[model samples]
Target: MGFCVESARVMLIIFNFIFWLSGVALLGVGIWFLADKNIVSYLEVVNHNVPNAYINYAAYILIAFGALIFLIGFLGCCGAIRRSKCLIGFYLFFLVIIFAGELAAGIIVAIYRTEIEHSVDKELSNSIKMEYTFANESAITKSWDTVQVELKCCGGKGPDDYMNSKFTNMSGIIIPISCCVLSDTNNMVAKDKSQCMNKVPEYYHEEGCKKKLIEWVKSHSVILIGVGCGLAGLQIIGFIFGICLCRSFKYEEK
Candidate 1:
């Protein structure tokens, strides 16, 4: 039993409505993530088929979490209207689950991020050496070419990274043409493929994909933490309202 049923009921409804909207925002963001040009392409590369595993999991997590939060918010609103203690209980249960999940995900990411990056680096280098066939043009080859051209980066490191790859090492080339400065990137027209391949300073990008990708990941971490904190604050609000409404319903009955 608790105090102020009437006020609690009204406030609970208002808060749940806001909660519902947050879910929608999450859903929208998740969909937007999937629609991002290069990000979507990166998401498709999972397990052994592709690298960038961190982002691959995040995409699914966002969509699924968004849907879950949407349902909880809807249930919270309904519970407040009917004064259903069971529904309120269910709402609190799920909110706790979500909180725990977010915490766990954060901890896991913090511990494993560097390890994951190293693993991906190894796999990417392996792909560049063996899987990215220059003659046959495997998926990895095209993907690497696209990454190099679009990101304006060279190999996993710099152009010299290709020195160990079969195609470049055997062919005695320093870098792929994709590394070259391009007048028309869409057409894959390098301004100086020969010079780029020969490691000319003017003809190619010096930065490595590994460094570029790490920076990209770091940039998104702040956004993720912001979103997580926002959701966490909302869930705390929900917990308060849920308890107030549940106990107040009992008090009114008594």
Candidate 2:
């Protein structure tokens, strides 16, 4: 085989191997997200009574997307191995579609992050003061508690924000135990119940859960963008190899 055909075949096969690994990683993450208690808590907030709930059922979406990627990688590998032009064409077509979709998603996220944050923060604040109640066993209550404890944060803005919530007026407590520096973070048991409940600054988390979440998202934005760029480059290279291989077929035939 000439350099073009041989090189293209090898490169495409390698690409498929890497793609398969990525699919497996995605699948694992999806499974982990579904099984994890913290992630389950996040689901409650994600499904808040809001239109365009973007991340609702996110674990399922990740699983489905991972499976599709796995299937495509398998098919692409087969095409490269067997030198099937038709299969290669189909592979390229689907890859292009995925590339476009992901690119658009990245663009949308970049353009809307600041603008969307305002509405999200507003909704979270409303949830804190208006919807939240202590020991209610409701989904919103549970989600807020989880966010407070797990994120090591207090209310939407801070512990004082609870004063406006039904949690304080009805329950007659200054702060939720979940806002405390918990002895058991997972179970929401406070390290010092008396001090924490009395609104002692030392025993409580000073930061706001909403603010912490926003910071976490911002901190990881660069990594997410880098990974996205890397994946796009991988797809682009695979597309190029497929094209070169197709041209080689005609070249060899001639």
Candidate 3:
């Protein structure tokens, strides 16, 4: 029985070490996602024009949860190494709370999936109509230009979506340079940027930003879902290990 308890303690310590490492990795990824200048640059467009706060909320939640997980994992590791029942018990309690909170969040998202999708589309369209401009001076303007250049897409719905835009009347330019596409040979030349000025269908991407964005999201949805499930599974395994460690400590005390 003593040997078994000792073995469990060793295993628990190993488990906690792995959990702590994972938490650190998660925290790093969250920070990278939030703080990367390029990513944040694109987010300026969303932040300025979109009314939807969910994206920012989600990012903040990820950072907070990752930090919590890191702290909890550290505590669990120490508790396991010392065979301290109080610390292990506290770890178990916190683990359960985190698990429940995640489960609740999943449920809420599932319930509102349709509404969320519609809201995102509506907000994106509104933002495009109200905020997008040809001038690339502001963060939001630069972000939209970046999106158009990177994605090779025009307005939210299409080039026609910009017909009534303030940019058209203000600049007397029908389309922005970012919307123009050059041939492979001329693509690198600076002067090619002005070549698409009056050239409509011949030089511009036909696909709308909204459709392209939605397609991009759809393509990655599976990966995101898999990652979420994997995290939940990890939490469940942590809970199990924590409980077993706490029980082993109790057995040893007796």
lDDT of each: 0.71, 0.72, 0.64
Q: Judging by TM-score against the true structure, name the best candidate.
A: 2
TM-score of each: 0.84, 0.86, 0.83
Predicted structure with the largest lDDT when compared to the true one: 2
lDDT digits (tens) for residues 1-254 of candidate 1 = 34488788788888878877877776676677678766553432213444345554554566678789878888888888888899889989999998876665555445435655656677656666776556635666677777788778877766666777887756666677788889898888989887776667888898878776666555655555556668789899889988988878877888
The clash tally of candidate 1 reads 0
At residue 186, candidate 2 shows an lDDT of 57
Model 3 lDDT-worst window of ten: 182-191
For candidate 2, what is the total of clashing residue pairs?
A: 0
How many residue pairs clash per model?
Answer: 0, 0, 0
Residue by residue across 125-196, what tens digits does model 2's lDDT show? 778787788766788888888888778888766777787578888888887888888888757678899988
lDDT of 2: 0.72
Q: Over all chains combined, what TM-score does candidate 2 have?
A: 0.86
Clashing pairs in 3: none
Q: Scored by Cα lDDT, where does model 3 land?
A: 0.64
- Candidate 2 error regions (>4 Å): 1-3, 29-35, 55-62, 220-224
Q: What is the lDDT of residue 134 in candidate 3?
A: 61
